[model samples]
Target: MMVDGVVARLRELDGELAPGDGVAVFNGMYLAVTEEVRDRLAGGRFDDPAAVAELDVLFAGRYLAAVAADQAGRRPAACWRPLFTARRQPGVHPVQFALAGISAHVEHDLPLAVVDTCRSRRCPPQQLSADYHRINDVLADLEARVREQLMPGPDPLEAADPLTHLVGCWSLDRARDAAWASAQALWALHRLPPAYAALATALDESVGAVCRRLLTPLVRRRSGGGQDQGGQDQLECSGLPSA
Candidate 1:
């Protein structure tokens, strides 16, 4: 199994991707595997390293195939979707079990992290605890590295905060576009808009700050003029968040 630091870092990086983006899809799979390990650890189902490796391969294969399908513009194959879907049945393929196990694990972990973070009055809604942040940073760095490897773009590490890069791509207008959808879903799932409202407020405030900070730097970096590069260097040397 991957170490906790590695797993946390992966989550941080993957979280930057728009939901359903290919990188996010792969991250989701790995998250599921980590969740399974957490669950077994909790329930006393500890397995040997060989068994863990087998599980990893199974989940990775399913995740990769799903990403490929998504890139090809097809609905995810049934195998790639969450296991609790009505189509799934008992005694399914071993891969199905692995997927199901991992899904449950991730589901549990998210709420736990959110709740823990929320409980810490000092913690920001959008950021995890320091250790968690470190783990997340590692994950974000890894994802950026992978993207650089495959896409060969400018230095993601230097250009902007990956989380901000992600949020900038998802502007307030985009979030507001789905406001109705989000309200309806939250109402149906949680039977409460008050909590959702609070989260929405926090998200709006955070996104607004992110937008202003990211805009000028983003424009400068993309403009690719020598002048912009100089400005960017000045901004960096000033040691202030972009604005």
Candidate 2:
């Protein structure tokens, strides 16, 4: 239901924003992932397509809710705070925006979605682990594609490159590992009054902080306000000051 609706919302966003817009870049990547999942569900890729659909809807709801909150001038969850605020900033790269959104969604929102799905389906967390892992695999594949398509390059491994440092620091693999742990913890604490909420809040705040750091602007230097790198022309920021 809601998962079906999310695809429409993402398409609306894609049409409204420019290609280079930070939010638009990330939304496009996310839209790809969501559509892939939608196809997988329709093709019966999972043991319980209905349950997987529920989880996907709940997971996407968190992101949609944050966008709504930001539009309304209200505070969104901590994990979403960075992407929402930095998405339109001039110096922030589209790759950074995409990764930051992924960080927030996977690290903070996903585990909670898993728990919620389990509760809704009257099942244990373990029962949903297969679907969870399958979804993660999808994300992992998409991340590689995103980097190939969106990353500005001078070879990310080049020494003394700021982008290299940023790339090294942000990893979806690590985030997914933490999310799985959080899901287990949340399931374990499900019946404990207040504790579950507190843990979830802590997870949200911690992931948000990571996203904030990831969105931190790196110095962009190029001539004539743009440059060709890795066979693609990119608009880059400028300026330098001596120490």
TM-score of 2: 0.86
Q: Which ten residues in a row have the lowest lDDT in candidate 1?
A: 234-243
Model 2, 1-243: lDDT tens digits are 566798999888889878767767778999999999999998888988988899999998888888789779998998888787777676666778889889989999999999999999889889988888999989999889877776776543332256556756888899899999999999999999599999998999999888887777755444344344433333332321110
lDDT of 1 by residue, 1-243 (tens): 343544565576467656534345446546644555544444544334323333333334444454557557775433233322211232122222232323322222223233333333333333322233333333344344333443314445555444234323532223322333333333343335587556544533443343223222122232344764653421121221221
Candidate 1's TM-score reads 0.25
Name the lDDT of candidate 1: 0.37
Cα lDDT listed for each candidate: 0.37, 0.81
User: Which RMSD does model 2 reach against the true structure?
Assistant: 5.3
Where does model 2 exceed 4 Å of error? 154-160, 221-243
In angstroms, give how far residue 133 of model 2 lies from its true place.
Answer: 0.8
